[model samples]
Every structure is written in structure tokens, then in C-alpha cells.
Target chain A: MAETVLSSGEKIFILHGIDADFRNDGRRRCEYRSMEIETKLMPQTHGSARLHIGNTDILVGIKVELDIPHADKPNEGKLEFFVDCSATATPAFEGKGGDDLATEISNVLIAAYQTRNAFDLKTLCILPHKKCWKIYVDVLILQCGGNLFDAVGIAVKAALNSTEIPKITAATLDGGEPDIELSDDCIQLDTSNYPIIITLCKIGDNYIVDPTLEEEVCSTSSIVMSVLPNGKISSVVKLGCGSIQFNTFTKMLQMGEIIGLKLNKTLMDVLKEENQFGRQRRIFGFLK
Target chain B: MPVDQRRINGPEVSVPYHIYSDFNKKSDKVKHDFSKRSDKRIDSEIRKIFLKTGIVSQAKGSAYIEMGNTKVVCSVFDPRELSNKNGYCMQGEIYCEFKFAPFSCQKRKIHQQNAEEKQYSLILQRALEPAVCLHEFPNFQVDVYVMVLDNAGSSLAAAIMAASTALANAGVPMFGLVTASTIGIYGNHYLMDPTDTEEAICNTQPDNEDDFNHGIITLASLPQHNQISEVFLIGSIDTNTIKQATEILTAANKDICPVLQQCLVKTIMKLHNEKK
Candidate 1:
């Protein structure tokens, strides 16, 4: 990506403002822009969600398929994540141009879900060594304005929360041949307590919660932290070319832990309240 | 399309309102029994149709079509130049991607263009070929991305409807409004706008895989001139049944033309109203 040059005076002004704990947009250090979340937006996916955080828009769809487990992990289920940085996000992402970013973000997801506490691989199991449910989480990037890691993580959690799985009625095996029957009624899984991601951007002397594109350009380094319901850190990824001091890294970790706890609680509350409100809640998706 | 008379074992198979199958043999059996005309529908009957536009505002043109429970959404993009050298075609191009949302049916599958979606794209290209003025832009291509929100039945037909509406919404020059719908025969009865369930019932029987031979007729028309652009039939429909289904589809499109044109006019008016 080509860099946009800023006048020396403008750079100095922004740097000075940051030093004084003020942003050009008049937002405080920890404040975030308004966001919108819509669940079950794409009817085709078992669970789908669309989230817009500022100018960054992310859509995540969770598809469930039955598959035979790997030889090494026959008893445990599997989770795979694929990210597509669509051209709609920016002209620069046209064609295969978005592959690099897609890989980077998906790697972050892999790390986040790698830990056992973050996602229970056993919950996706169907049969001991025969069949297991594989969830393919496909994230489609529609737009980008910055702080994408936090937005994408939040959207993935929401999409997983809204996912509904078909109830398997019976699975019979005769002579090592299996026949599967599905129940007529559908069942929804509880994902309200799913993991939440807290991306801490190390700015001048402080670590900001979420950074806009401009703020991202100014930051030297950032850490993306994924936290599960029990306050356990699932994954922590450091980004940017700037080196981080040991003291700053520890401080950022503390900040992430505090923020992650609050984020998980708030997300659960919102999802529960929305579910309790049910269909009466006005449906707002892409149209809105 | 003639439904391959296959067993209805898939959890997605439905038989409540609409039945799927080739209608010739079943209609023949029903006709032999003579229990008054099945369906009690008029010769010019049409399935219940509903359309929603501006559903995907991010796209330049978008529309959603629902024929009974069969629902499809299409997004239209470009007269823009092809970004890739290999992705271009001579007579203007129509790049279509169709996918069934994992939750759209009983079994949730990964997101990819499946064999079924590929088949539909070819059929849709055939249906819209005559209606679209592809010669206008020789090197440019129009991409249509259709996602099946629900798979009750007739998704291709609904996709056709959605695509046409999206083109109009995009202000693409067209001869006129194009609407496509499917009609089928079950036993001795001719059913209009069969749902996925109805489609299944039409395509099945108690014993064998007879529904595979069931005939399905899909008709796309300009509706104003009574000119048919595409008429597809699967299974075996004798000359008379074909004529009957064609007449039914043609007349239904004829009736819907004004309504469809009125929608276009209303949308245009809204655009102008906003400008003013």
C-alpha cells in the first residue's frame, strides 16, 4: 500500500495532541466509535453476523459440516477459519491482492482458537471415531477503516453466538457403515459466553483500546489479545515494526486483561438481552 | 427442469405446500382417476411472488425475490472494465456466483459454488441471454452474486426474477421487464409455483425412483409482447402439456409485466424525487 504523506506541521500537531491525551476527532483515549451488530443476517449460513465498527465493516458466516476426524485427533473436533478480503473493502484488495492480509488475520484467529479453554473441541464431536462436526468460519471483509482485528473478532463471536445447528436424531452403524438421520426440530447452541478480543494499541505513552486508521498509522506497535469467558487469554499477537519495551508490554497486558473481562461480560449481556427480546427486536442488517 | 425422481431421504426434502417432480406420468395417473381437476387452479394460475429491492445497499444494484418460500437475493455490479485479462470475454460477460447459505437448508455445508449452483448459473445465463443486450459492451462484464436465503423451491426461477430486477435497478438498458416462473404437473394436476415440499412430492412416489422422470417447465418472458425468451422443460412433457404450461407461464408474466414496470417507474420516481 502506498503511504499518504502528511505535512510536517500536521504531523507535529497530531503528535503533540496525542502527547496531551487528545485526538483530532475529540475522542478520549479509551473511547471507541459507534458500532452496529446484526445477527442472522445471512440466512444461508447456520450462523451469520454483520458488524460495522466505524468505517470498517465485517461479515462472518459459520458453516457446519460433518467430517471424519484426522487420524491423530479422532476424538477431538476441528475448527477452521478462512478470511476473504473482498475488493469492496478497497481497490487495493482487488483480485489476489488481499491474500496477505487475509492470511495474517486468519493466523491470528488460529492462535486465538488454538487453546482448549477458548473453544471446546469436544462440543463439536458427533461420534467417537466416525463423525465429528467441523465448523468452517468464513469471514468476508466488506470495508476497512481501521481497528480491524477487534472488529473482526467481535463479529466472529457474534456470528458463532447466533449459529443454530440441526438436531441429529440418530446415527446407526451396521458393518462399519453409518446412516445418519436428522430431527425435524432445529436447536440453537449457547455461545453467549464466547471469547472476546481486546486489541491494545501502544500510542505515545498510553495504550489505546481501539485505533482508527489514522491512529493506527501513528502507532508504532499493537497487541491483539483474545480472552475467553473465564478471563483466560486465548491468544496474544504483537504487530508492527516498532519494538516494544518490556514495561510497556506488561502494562498493555494488564490493560488487555481488564478490558477483556469487561468486554466478555458486556457481550454476554447484550446477546442475552437481544435473544430474550426475540423476533420483536427490529431486524437491521445491510439495508439499515 | 425435470426433477430426477429420487428418494426424499434428505432432511431438506419438503412436501407440505409445493411438490417437486416431473408432472407427466403423475398427471396422467391423476387424470385417469378423474377426481375433478387437481389444484382447482385456473389455467393461467401463477405462484405467489414477492419482490424486495435495495436489500443490499452497498451494492450498486440489488434485489430479493421470493416465490412462496423459495427466496433468492442478487447483487449487480458493473459495466466496469474487467480487472483481469483472463476474466474477460468478447460478447460482454456475465460472471455469476450462486451459493446456498449453510443455514438455508437442513444440512449446513461450507460456502462454495457447488454442482447445483453451477448448473443454475448456466441455466440462468441461458434464460437471460436474449433479454440482456450484451453487445452494448463488448469487453466489459457484469457480475451477479446470488445467495439463496431459503431453499423451499424454485430458487433458480427466483434468482432469475431477482437478477432481472437488479439489472433494472442498475439502470441497465433492457427491452422490458423479464420475469421467470416455474410450473409443474403432479399426478393429473398442474401446480403453479410449487414450494420445495411441493416440488419434492411431485418428484417422488412410494416405491421407486419415478420422480426422476417428472417433467418441470420454466418459462421466462418479456411479458409485454408475449414474446418468450427462454422456455426450459425437463423430463417428458407431450406437446399439449408443454403448450398448457407455456400458456400458463406466458399469461402469468403478461399479467405481472405492468406490476413490474410500475415498480421500475416508482423506483425511478423516487430517485428523481431525492435529487429534487
Candidate 2:
């Protein structure tokens, strides 16, 4: 991960701040930074969204393509997660330097969405054992403030929500071959059950949500948990060099569930409010 | 027939895709018109540029430049201790990395840097080395990274301009600033700062073997030094046409040099005021 070196004293100050239930930005341990989201910004893609959480800016674009379903799972579609860490975020991510981190984040996303109830791939199936909608969720990290996984997950959800898949109007068998026709109407995806990840960084004895670069440097370990809207934990992954006891790990998981639920609720509310604006929603990409 | 397990599989859709057909129709309609480009700019006019410095707070210096829809961000890191040591070295090394975002182009780019990106990195390094005073930072290395947010056209030229401005913003000693611009030659007409579509149309080779008068020329130069640092040409064109294109690119670079100077001045003034 791209990070800054924090001195011991600075680390102690952050630990003390967390112990008091207050962070450097004057927020509670569970509080999150203000986020700005805009959807359908990239006209080229079927669905696109730009998200800013503090300084970690992410752009997610979803492209839907037609492909043959797997033989084992002929009725299900496919979801692919691709993460590109832009060199502008840090010099450490230049060229192939960021590939390892990108693969790690993408793997976590794939695992999060792999659950049966997390995302229904059957809805994307156009025809059994034939054509299906393959959704490609490409995430671009323009800047890294901290807490990248959570930011990427939220942006992916927003993009997937805004995605409009072309409706198949007609399918027929002509001369022993299947033929498909696409309609002008595009159907908006139902992303209500999409999973959102929340990363809790352990600083000293307590865990904090949304660790900044300095706080991340001071953290010994972090737990990333993906929570669905129905309060189901889809996946869990631990990062950093620090180890946690089994009891502490269980507590961390519980804390993750609580914070993840809150984050999802707020995210849904924000998306709902933005949708109410309809076509009048202003798009401010990186210009802002 | 056996399935190819090595390649990622997808749902098989019918032929004659609607999206591709729509794009083809749109382009076919524009192929005949030669009066002006699609964006309503004349043959010689360049797109409007929006340039800013110090956009990345973490980097020592950074710049973001947008030419119409083309967006490029370049960041310069502070001088760091060189990892490779081979005897005594007098001049510092400069490393350049160029990348295009997955969704920057019409087609989605992969996470890894492709062959074209690596080639552009080499070109950028050559373009920037002429301007930087490398000997000042002995036993250290400075890294410049350029990311293309949106690739409309003239991305290399835009990267060159952004990287040079970012170096100046970082307070790196340099002989002069480098400005760059690209021109597309189609038949007898020269298109300045062509967009992606225009570039494709210009670069497309005709089926007939007799007619081959299309190419793209990118020129990076120091206007004060009156010397060209790098020239990247693709496709095929006559020598005379190449000369004409170079002149046009040089003039465009001259036009853009003042804008770059103004941007650097604004960044320096901001830094100076912050110091107070």
C-alpha cells in the first residue's frame, strides 16, 4: 500500500486520539468523511460513477457485454472486477508497482460478490446455455487518501446501481440457430442487495473506521468485512502485520458488522436522495 | 469443439451487435464531410486547454491538463536515494511511467501497461531529459508519472506538457520548459490536436496501394531554446508533408508555451504566498 511514514510520537498521538473516541479530524471513531458521488459521468460506458471520499477519488465504470454462460452454471451471468491504481495517486504505483495491490483489492471484491444472495447473477441470464450479460466493473483509483477498499466498494455499488442493461426484446430459433433482438429500452439494475465493504483499522487496543494515511501508518492490523443489506457478512479479510487473538478477532467481526450496516444504510439513503433528483442531478467529475 | 479454458469465457451473443452497428453508421456519415472536424473546430485550430498545478497534495509537484476531453495528470516525486549503485555517478536518473485508465478510451484498457503505454513512457523520458538539470541531484533519482484520465487525442503531447510543468512545480532545476503538440496529416489538410475519431480517420490506410498520404506527427520542443527534443511519427506520409506538419506542430507548441508559463507562475506565486 502507498503510505506515509509517521513518527513514533505521531503514532502515539493518533492512538491517544482513538482511545478518547475522537480522531484527528474531530470525528468519532465510527464516523466517516464526507463523500461526493456522481453517476453516468462517463458516457462511453453503460454505467459509470465518480466517487470522492475525502481525498481518495475513484471512478467506476460498468460495461455489459454478451457472452456464452459456463456449462456448469448456464443460467448464471458473470461479474468481473478490475482495479487500476493510477500512478497519479503515488509514485510507488507507477508502472507495474501497483499490480500487487490492485490484484489484492480486486480479489477481495470478487470474493465479496461471490455469495449467492449478495448479487443475483441469474437476472443477467438472457438465455439458458446460450447468451448472457457479462458485467465488467472497472475501478480506477485516481488519488489515494486512505481506506481504499471501502471507497472502491461503495463506488462499485453506485456504478452498478446506475448501470442500464439493454433489454432483449426477441429471441427465436431460425434454421436451428438462436437469434436475439435487443430493444431500445434499457433496464436499470437492482443493486439493493449489493455488498459494501467496511475496513476497521486497529490502532492500539481500539479499532477505528476510515483510517487516514497517517492513521493507517500507525495501525498494526485492519479487518475488511463486506456486509449485505440483509445484515449478512459476505466475506472477511485481514491485512497488515499485526495478529489478533481469537476473542479479539470475534469482537472485531462484530464491530465490523455494526459499522458496515450503518455505512450501507447511509449509502442507500444517499443513493435514494440522489435518484429523487432524477435527470436534474448535477455532474461534477474531477473538476470539483 | 473443445472449450478454451485458458481464456476467460463470456455469454455468446448473436452477430451484428447493435452498438457496433450504431458506431459504424455514425462514422460512415462523417467520413465524407471535409469542411470541418466533428467538434466544429477548423482544420488548424486546437482544442481549448485547461491546465492547473499542485493538484496532487502528496506529490512534491503535480499538474493536470485537459485538452477538450483529453485529461492527463502528471506528478513528480521528490528526489529519493538511488537504489542501484554502480561506482560514482555524476548525473541523476529520471524515470517516467505513462498509463491510460481502463475507461479512458472507448474500449476498456487492462490494468497492466500495454506495449503502447511502455513505448510512450520511453518517449516521455526522452522528451523530459533535455529540460531537466540531472547533474544537480547526484546519487538521487526523480520519478515522473503520467496518468491519462481521458484519451481523446494527442495524449503523448499532453503528457509531455504536463510532466514538464510538474517538474517545474516541484522546483527541479531545468534548462527550459518543454511544450508539445501533435498534428494529423490527411491528404493535403493538417488537423491540429485531432480527437480520437479524427486521429483514427487520419491514420486509416486506404485499400488502394497507390494512395498513401496519412500520418501523425508529435513534436516536443523548447521554444526558448529553439531546439526540438523529441519527435514521434506514426503511419506514412511524404517528406514534404512531414516538414509541413512539423512546422505546424512547432507553431502550436509556441502558442501553448505561454499558457504553460502562466500556470507555473501561478503555482509559484501560490507557494510563495503560502510560505509567508
lDDT by residue (B102-213, candidate 1, tens digit) is 7786556445554456556655665565567777777787888888998977777788888888888886666666777777555456767666655554443223322222
Per-residue CA lDDT of model 2 for A1-288, tens digit only, reads 784877788889989999999899999998899999888889799999888988899999999999888764578898988899989999879887887678667866875786455676888888877888999999999999999999999999999988999988997777756689998999998887788988888889888888898899998667776777766566555565344443455566677777887888888898888889887667776685
- Tens-place lDDT per residue, model 2, B73-137, is 99999998887634456678789999999889876666667646765776788778867888899
Q: Candidates' TM-scores?
A: 0.50, 0.53
> Poorest 10 consecutive residues of model 2 chain B by lDDT?
B1-10
- Per-candidate Cα lDDT values, in order, are 0.68, 0.80
- lDDT tens per residue, model 1, A189-260: 656435677788877777787777777777756776676666555555456533344346556666777777
Q: What is the lDDT for A206 in model 2? A: 88
Worst 10 residues of 1 chain B by lDDT: B204-213
